[model samples]
Target: MDSTPGVTIDLTVADQDSKRFGSAPSPIKIGAVRMHGWQVHPISVASDQFDGADAYLVKFNYELGTTPDTPEMNWFELGVELREGVVVDAIPHHTQPTQTSVSYIVNDHLNLVPATNGVTPAAHLPATGETIHVFGVGSSGVRWQYWATSDTGVRWGSRVAWLVTLVDQETTHLDLTTIVRFDQRPTLDWNVLPAVTPADLRIELPTATNPRAEVTTQPANGTTVALLPSSPRVFISYTHDNNAHKQLVRDFANLLIKCGLDVRLDQFASPARKDWFLWANDNIDNADFVIIIASPKCLAVGEGKIDRNEHPGMHCELGIMRDRLQGNRRLWEQKLLPVVLPGESLSNIPVFLQPQAMDRYEIDELTEDALGDLLAAIHHGTEDNSRSPVVLMATSARRALADS
Candidate 1:
């Protein structure tokens, strides 16, 4: 084992002249690299030339090893310096992992199976001609670093490089996928360099999109378990407390949407002439989870302190939630979640919901890390097991006794 990570580059395609360049449909040159005892294989690299725009779209698909000896690849960067005649028309976007797998060697036998647990690294175009994607393995979240360039000197051609860094020791793999667009047909030569010192760079703590699905381990026998769908239908229930509060709720909903949740919020609905009450009720019934954002106005409406005519929409939603919970306590209890935003208080939760006795998610900030527990609950249905049925019944009985 080498203390310093070793790098090996392997060009998968040998006949470069055989492949036609520009206008004519041709395959992009694909290559592989082995870094830190793990193999970085380019599964496919497809390129499409624009009809008359003289532009091209390239999609890269790469898979890395996931064995125990595989080093933790913290960040991966793709850079393209355009030729004198070419220019970058658009920044790279739409980066996500398409698939993930795990490999285990047991009893001198090699077994490869699909893994349910994996993180989708966040992609950022921090600077021109540079796109960096990073993922974290532990509690400490992803750290982003970008380079500063004042080198505006004239150059004849551009250079493209793919850099991967192994910052820690962990057993995880990443299936990197991204699409890049160029104004003109550019060279797709990806040069892998060993540990070059980045110049004029600054490390910053940036927010990352939540993983598409929560991480789950496969059984020791290499049995693949069914994982939650990538996008869960989530409905956000909250009162129009104020302009600021409404904006906060909207921001939270947007964040959930970015995390791959099909979020349903009143703010996102159109202002067409229709029955708002029916809309609220229908979404509540159809949603995978209805997140009840805790606030003073929401508590007032849920507890009947506010007049129904004042906030008919919130009133209608609360009525539907109450009916569903009374109809099926166990099911609705798991589906209806009480959430307190950063500036909100837990005491603002509705009384009939048994806020004191049940689990409530407190969001510390408007970041993915703050919503980890809520996301996990939605993905794994763990909240349903948080409290036993017997315990819930006892809590209801206690509430009844207290009211008497």
Candidate 2:
């Protein structure tokens, strides 16, 4: 074991880990993880996209070698495996919180490592002859895989990072914040969970906030668990800028509803007595399809419109759509529909929505092509990618775990 502070002791040679990882690298590359740390830093990042959810996300970052001399070569990769929620919230040591989390760059790719040292480094796991016993802090491990740049020549490692939301979870101490390195993985049992490195580093911790699990499930903070009817529902999102244009959206909703769709419209879903914001969000959260009648006024309200703004209701609907479909290409393809109404330039569409295929129809010369496409797309039910078909990590669950 290297006596250097924060250095991980190298264990078991090439053959085993190579086979475990399905690679046959040399002994030098397999063991003796040179350097990693929970060294903290603040970064500007969007708060966990699904806000006000119970799940918390934390990032673990570290540097390679002791200096900039560490050789990060091609096909050389660094990844991390940890129980979800093990990375509870933390304000990176310095600077104000700006949706920050730990992060680093190994070679050119973003890489992940452990946050706390209480978790035993693989080198410290029980050896073959010892009584192997280990338990998990999370229901499953979260793995972030990274690969080296084969094309570029060897480069020194960059400080790695994870910009994650704060989370809270029940925790157990394996001899409270102990750092252990073992030769092999211990046979794990529930009674004794795996250990973690203590928060030994002297980075000032920020004031702990409420656990993400306790987050509010409202339209503003955001939640994905929909609240709409099971029927294929469509949400008419538009602006009331022009009287005739507003009627067009109303007519559009009526058309979809007449075709056996449960269409939710502003004037229809929101009675004057009802909270339009909440009503719009309900459909945005639950509706099967969202047809944005892309217009300058509608697009302006998407983000430029805020809480007290005239188009706050429209902003809520469109903003929620952006959050829900952030990285989900599958759902974006199914759940969101943008139609260019007459006299509205494509520039009216938000930058995020611009790349999407839009259905074009003029209010004065309305055609069936755009409307027909919208109908067909929404009729095909939204695909639930929530189920992890394999043992792989479920992003939804991980996301919740992330912010929790």
lDDT (tens digit, per residue) of candidate 1 on 1-404: 11323333332212222211212223232333333332221111112211111111111222222223222222222322211112111122222333222221111011112223353221112223422222221111121212112232111122222221211112122322221211111123521111221112111111123122211212345333221222467899998878679768877876675565657776544223347778888899989899999999998998889877777778889889999999999899999999999899999999977889988999989998888999999887633345533234234323332332
TM-score of 1: 0.42
Off by over 4 Å in 2: 1-231, 270-272, 303-308, 327-329, 356-364, 367-370, 381-404
Candidate 2 lDDT, tens digit per residue, 264-311?
A: 665432111345557777877777777788787776676474344676
Going through the candidates in the order shown, the clash numbers are: 0, 37
The worst-scoring run of ten residues by lDDT in candidate 1 lies at 104-113
**Top-scoring candidate (TM-score):** 1
Give per-model CA RMSD.
Answer: 22.0, 23.5
Off by over 4 Å in 1: 1-230, 382-404
How far out, in Å, is residue 324 in model 1?
0.4
All models: lDDT? 0.45, 0.40
